[model samples]
Target: MPDSGEVQAVKASNPGDSQVRVYAVAPRENADPDEIVDGFLEAMTSDDPGFATARKYLTRKAVRAWKPEESISVLTNAPDRDQADRPADESKGRTYPLSGRQIATVDASHAYQPNAPGEYNQSIHVVQQPSADGKSKEWRIDSLPKGLVLGEADFLRNYRSVNKYYFASGENWVVADPVYIRQRQDPVTRMDPVAQTVKALLEGPTGWLDPAVDSRFPSGTQLAPGVTTLVTDDQSTLKVPLNAKADRVSAVACKGMAAQLLFTLGDLTSVRVEQVEIQGSKGDRLCLLGKAQARDEYAPVRNAGHSENPYFVDEHGKLMTLSVGGRQPDRPTEVPGPFGKGVVPLKAVAVDREESHAAGVVQEGRELRVGSITADEELPPAVVTSSGVRPADRLSAPSWDGRGDLWVADRNPVKPRLWMVPGGQGERIEVSTPWLRDGARVESLRVSADGVRIALLVTKDHHTTLQIGRVERTFTDDGQTVAVTDLENAAPRLSSVTSVSWAGPSRLVVVGTEAGGVQQVRYVQTDGSTSATSVLPGLNGVDAVAAPYGEQAPVVADSGNDGIVRLVPGANWQPVVKSGGSPVYPG
Candidate 1:
């Protein structure tokens, strides 16, 4: 048997893979109150289905009241347990105080939200109770936290984040909704990771994303009875059996369901799910979808073929591009357009996803100009202009969505607003942002590739912070109206945020500083949670940062001292250009 506080590892039988499965030992006989507490905490981090082993250390009454599915508290490390100061009485029980630095929490909805490092204090009371046989007495916890408490390392080891795909509301393109699931078998449902992912997809998107996305699965749809383990066949195809609720879905809706499953299961690195075959209640085949078919029919915006090279404004205020992929020349070449020829000095530039059009902020940040990047063309007339005298109080850097729409923010204190230009040239529409009506100014903004979400850097009361808002569009007699609603702080831990950019479907790379700390660059999830490896290597004087949608692509940034630099995986930041600023990747 493994030693106390140690977990035993064995191969998983259901998946038939080399993945290790973790198990925790039950409470030992004659264990003291401290030992029982320690055993229970260790069990919380193991793969014991339904946490049965962990409950062995709790009293019968505690077992009946505890709800491990309520929430999960994650800390920086294992909590320290110390005996409380109160005198211990055998009849009154003993209290062990647990303390740690709390980092994040996963609620009952399986949505993970991060918090600034804060003190965590709780108590576990243990008392002598009759053993299960009622013949002897044993130390058992009578009162404790309602949910699991785990260290960051243990949490990462046991839980994995998976993106469950959902279609953008009223749109064909799918959006990624990230949620945490067990790395092995889930303790509650006794379902493996693949099954858990499929179940989550059926359950629908999280609260934050529900309003912006839609699930094609019919209401009350679920996995077939007695089906828990999901495995791919020799052909790399997964067959999913669903309950009667999904028996009547149309062929089109069935394909959407299969696409959702394909995308969700593709994120599980342990298994290869290339094709998905959906079965009805009576085992009748509903639809079959292959990876290629799904991509062609329901391709995500991120895979819409954005440029790989990073773009920036050179020392002469001309737009330039540099090749960062595979043995390419490090030399920076001016783009083939008026913006590249310095027709008008630029302060910032945003390239469309297809790299066919570019938007540049010129005339001292007061005018927004859109021009072609693939051919020589005169810089078009200013599409939008700001009356603010100071550059800092004027237009922000422009960002384009996959649908060929342009997003920019005007920070004129008297009339701050966010504008969207249809097809990068039509009349600009002011996107309603009620949250900004309270004297907050949008300093910068980036639209998600799906065009369903937008990230804004807002300033108020001398403090700048990062917030994400849902971009909701509604068509009526007035044509189409847009509003950015349900804004949430994406980086509350950062005392101030200077730059924010989307790195993936549900992740952002931000440059910010914590209270009483120096500036740093880190990755934060759209749900506000962060992982232990989120922080990048140190770099100084970073003015702006941009990351490509794919993880394998290098992150580019503009630094005051280092100029333009790129950070490749497994390496520190390397200077890309010694004279460029406002570096950015195609949106």
Candidate 2:
């Protein structure tokens, strides 16, 4: 061991130079009108606190009236700058046009929609103004669009998503209420992200998600007064202190309150809250146990189930499963059923959540049939519905809801409608889709896991689009099944959708070509408020896609050349079966 003085001398000789260098760039100080426009646009990407630096390039009047959070345009690439009109005098005001293909647009509620083609361009008007120093005239933006524009990559980098927990219809389980958050909203230092997530949870669900989900917090419940930060005790336990209002609820409701916080905080990658201790404003612990607890302690009430793996029909029209990690016995093994034997080629197929039953459309695209996967003998599939319409306007692939109901679209031009086969056994029941516009046909539809929502791919005026709506089940006075109401087009901007599937509790994975011509797999929140980054870079002829419920479950798709492609972690798309089409996961 070296002496204190020797250690100091050694430290001096071998300095630990692992210091981080933060190069702070000063805001642009140019006075040229063109330069001012450029600087203003550049500063928008900075995400500066309140956009302080970007305001420097704006006139006082314009800055006061502008609202940055009004909207955001996600462009395919950087804006193309052009001089709209040249002023005769260099010092006079002029306008510059910045145009780009917008892939998506986000509203104030953070809901993302695809912007209509040719409607995403921006026009900036810059004028001469007296500088703050009062020494010289400078060019500053006087009038501009209401929203900010950024490249897709930059937009994804600055925004993130966190799901707030809410009670489902029965309150027997909890569902996720996804909401967008700035990437930096959660602090990195002294601020606890787990605490911040809880605060967001206390705010309740967003407008769109509220009607579909419910909260368990008491009417006036809130965080403890005068406490803005979340405190954690030793052993990584989270101490959540609630107001006096929380005490008004029953013991069961209090447990639900604890569950909501635990699920929301656990979802954050930045924080690992193993145990949560719920306390009252007076520091008295609430609910049963009155001690720190783990997520497993509350798993009985969470939506902890996931969907079964995906199954697909091979090029030869044999139903098979891709052996992932030996989850399935035979690699690309033909399923044990009539459809699996290749007697009747299938166009599209869907399996029930229990994996015991399946529904499919025959190759002719006119007949929809249902069969059992657990049947040992080669039994004939029962035909549920058959359409006499043209192939292009005939029956689409089948979808299974959580209730084991089979849903399919009958796009007969003269009588376009949606039909459901109760448990794949009873007669076909025609469901009313009144919200579908005139001449718009349902190309495809998939029901969410909870069976409360449905995503429809509608084709109107030759444009294929995706929409979502509430699934209102109506019954006769005697409790007999009647008409099913579809509140369609929940995600209006997911245009030209080729295929889609529920990828999470409240999120859907959509594959489509945006207005900008970028075709890839993207995730959209069920509320239609935000569109996340593409799940996979791009695939050739992604005719169909399917995903299970969990976060890390394998996503399979039917594509050309590569046949069946599976999305593995880190890797984008890898061939699974080598040749298959129309993939479907258990609903």
Candidate 3:
């Protein structure tokens, strides 16, 4: 019997801001068919370690055949028995068919994507099985599905996406690699939240993201032998012991490893990891100097140099920053640059992180120009021009990287390529991305605040899909070069993606159609897991969307209603500006 616990969304205070839900554990019982079925379903949706209890409902043969990780179906309701079945026989096996509508499916690799909301039927064959004491026969599932299924709310309660840190390829900084995990584990369980995170970091990234990210932990590295739990000491310090393999690394490398641990552990919402103490196999603390480090040098740069207010291009093609937080210039003020002068009929725009530069596409969408946000002089020259390509095949909305470089992709099917304007000016360098294939043309691109990733909305065969790729960079004596590689589908299940904005370091707000074929605004993790949070409410006719940083207010261009709408999480979308399209935030 499962505890009578109701599922509810608990807002996360971490940077990811994705909702975390709590699930109650089900008590063990294996008597009748209904009890066995109820307990099995409840256990499948729990974060129980080893799933030892769930196996109790199954016969020895069925337990061995079931592979819960093979797939997970998200449903809107609990699976109910097929009413058409005949009465159960006490001496012979009986099949209990269950059915529900699947909202999504999590594949073996744990990629959560939308699924067509239609009937999904499964079954379990049950019969009397000898008890552990051989004293009595109990109803046990003789056959079961290979994977698991749970209502949408239960899925949210048991699973969450967490970012484990890895050193960038250059080892100059750390990068977040998001992965799904249990939000809360049983206290008496072997998989401690902190320990599980450390183990995952050591295990490294998935096959698809391995090329784009690197780990400081050495190859074949493992946590110290017999290490199954991690708890802070009386002084509130987390002590993590690693195998002897890490002892040979230099102090700098040790520090980098510690930094990765610090950031990754800090992202755990329920844990308060004030400091991380890394230990060697011999039980001595390594990296003493780095152990008490308070600041995270690898965290994404936020508001430091970014505009405190949001901005949009008005109907007249002028750039204007909205007055937020009761700041000066009460009314919407035009930016102090060529965009403010309205000389170019701009169709789309983006500003650099420092709010010092701007990039936009001309009304014809055939040219991409960059200019100083505060410059009173003429607009910067067009850095990219498509002379023969159709206007619609010209360029996408520009995105500014943390390095102050501008990125845009030409939609020309004949020669489509992403271009990087280093420092937002000068030479137009073609960024080769072999994964942007199948005749897909870039529709929009937004760089993450960390600058190592880009979210892309691409159209192919008349359908649009959202994808994420790594921006690999190399610096030389002459300058820097960048390329977007390892492009992974972020919303492969989405049929149409109109807009995508970075809501947090490892999270994106995606507007698209679900596999069920309904359009809505929802949160998506970089690793392709859909957020359990409900879709943004009342978002209609959103042509574009812009977000400043981590879970901050996001504004949308409601082209259908001729107004700009602002999204307040858990609330309705409020109309902000009366007219605008292609709204954008400072890079």
Candidate 4:
């Protein structure tokens, strides 16, 4: 409360009195009751910003007045030059503990002075305040653990969370973040205040005491959640999840999905993902097409599949397939296929556009030959509007589950056997399907919505068989799969299946071949119930089969085509794609 004039007067008359004993702040008699001042002193132990220099000097309570430029930072204005040498234990006054308590009324009279706009010091006039009990005083500054320093910055550079400044003799004390900045950037300064201030103080101490110098250090530890990483120029950054336990480590980039790592290990570094399968969010299934040795790391998913219409299945279980390779796929887009007179070719229907399906007709287009219905016309459909299970495109046509979107698979128009569904658009996941490059005949296909699970049926040489596949993926990227089983024991039946539709999940309609002289229609249910009805003389129904193996040859097995012609014998025979008429097994 001393005015500027008084302060000047006191300073002029006491050239030698401008010094005070930092240790004399022990006990004082009740010489002037109303003139007493007292408060607490916080003792900090960590190098955190808030407590950077607080523990170096005899720090005063929050209410204590402080002056950083004093002879001793903890001591205020001055008493007498002689007091500088007094022993700290001289019993100069009564003291009390104020470390973890709230205290008030710590006054500065030659003993303490204001150092800055918002700070305090230890060389303060202390007076004990009444405790809540109102009997004896409890909060006091004398009871603090002795030998602790109340620090002050010699030259604070910036008031950053971590006090980056010079102290003691101009050495540096950069109170840095222990857990946070540890993985961030290396500290530019040290935390030993006295040692930090020595160099600067010895040079020109006034520069160390400039008002513009900041004194705040990094104030926190792993105290809260935040993104504390140093982003690099080469598309690299430390992605640390705040809530993560103290020691978990992980590395990820635009390369692919997030990968797990050694927990006890320190900060994360980039890693190459061996393989990975991605699950689409909600109802969308993921499809990563083509073997992209490095395509999994694409930033926005690279869709390089040619215009062969990919079967698309929306979230609502709708299926659609389109024709792709019209010309070079860039010119006028088209759904291409062989469409000629006297040609009973397999037709492609957009499983997605059920309403627009060409019910019964044969037309020739510049790109694709929109095919016609089987001339039998006697085949009554359960749902005519949904159209037949013909793939309209050449893109890898994976079998449909009626739910998930398109999964990357193999598409051979020359050996079009199985049917497939389409895919929808959105924040989609990608799963690249692994097909055996054995070149074997693929008979059928199935996939999980996650795009990581698959089932394939293939034929080896002349043997009929089934193969299964499962894909495994973790984090944001790694994925791979293995075939589970290959069954070659099943016998050949009549005509190929009219359809392979899944019903009530985990179950499908095993539509048997159509019935003729030797071909017969058959249907098998998951409950072990099967039915067969002969609608034709020798042309029995046929079931489409899927074969697995990239190196194996394509097989066109079919139910026998032993039907009769009432009129013309040559034109009476029906052509069923590449599926030949094999003898229909009665078993």
Structural similarity to truth (TM-score) of each candidate? 0.92, 0.75, 0.82, 0.22
lDDT tens digits, residues 81-111, model 2? 8976877986668999889777676776555
The sequence of per-residue lDDT tens digits that candidate 3 reaches over residues 1-587 is 88889989974323222254324354344466777777788777655566776877778888788877677787766676663254655677777888977767776555555544677888877788777788877888878877878776666666676788776676455667876565666322367767777887888876656776788778877899878778877766788899988878887777777788887887887777767777888988887423235243555553433335677888898888885433122467888878888889788889888888889899588888887778787876789976536777878888987667788888888877888887888788888777667787888899887678999887889888888888887779977777887677777667789988886667787888865666687777887766535466646666777765755444444555757766655555666778767777677
Q: How far in Å is the alpha carbon of 44 misplaced in model 2?
A: 3.3
Candidate 3, run of 10 with poorest lDDT:
13-22
Model 1, range 100-164, lDDT digits (tens) per residue?
99988998878888777899999899999888798989999999987989877777777888899
* Model 4 misplaced regions, further than 4 Å: 1-347, 350-398, 412-435, 441-443, 446-455, 462-499, 511-520, 523-587
Candidate with best TM-score: 1
lDDT against the true structure, each candidate: 0.88, 0.69, 0.73, 0.25
What's the C-alpha lDDT at position 395 in model 4?
28
lDDT for model 3, on a 0 to 1 scale? 0.73
Residue 503 CA error for candidate 1 (Å)? 1.5
Consecutive 10-residue window with the lowest summed lDDT within model 2: 11-20
List model 4 lDDT by residue over 1-587, tens digit each.
75565333343322221122122232233323212322123222123333323322322453143332222222222121111233365335443212211111112111111221222322432334554467755323322323222322201111111111211111111111001111112122332321122112112212212221222111121211332232222322223222212222222221211111111011122222233222222212222112243333221112222221222221222222222223221211112221112232323222211111221112210012122222212322211111223443232223322132333232343432232222332222433333333545454445522232244445446443323333333333442222222221111232233333222111222434323533332222222222222122333334332211111211112333421111111222233222222111000
Off-target runs (Cα >4 Å) in candidate 1 are 1-22, 85-89, 302-307, 328-330
Candidate 2 vs candidate 3: the TM-score winner is 3
Q: Better model by TM-score, 1 or 3?
A: 1
RMSD of 4: 31.8
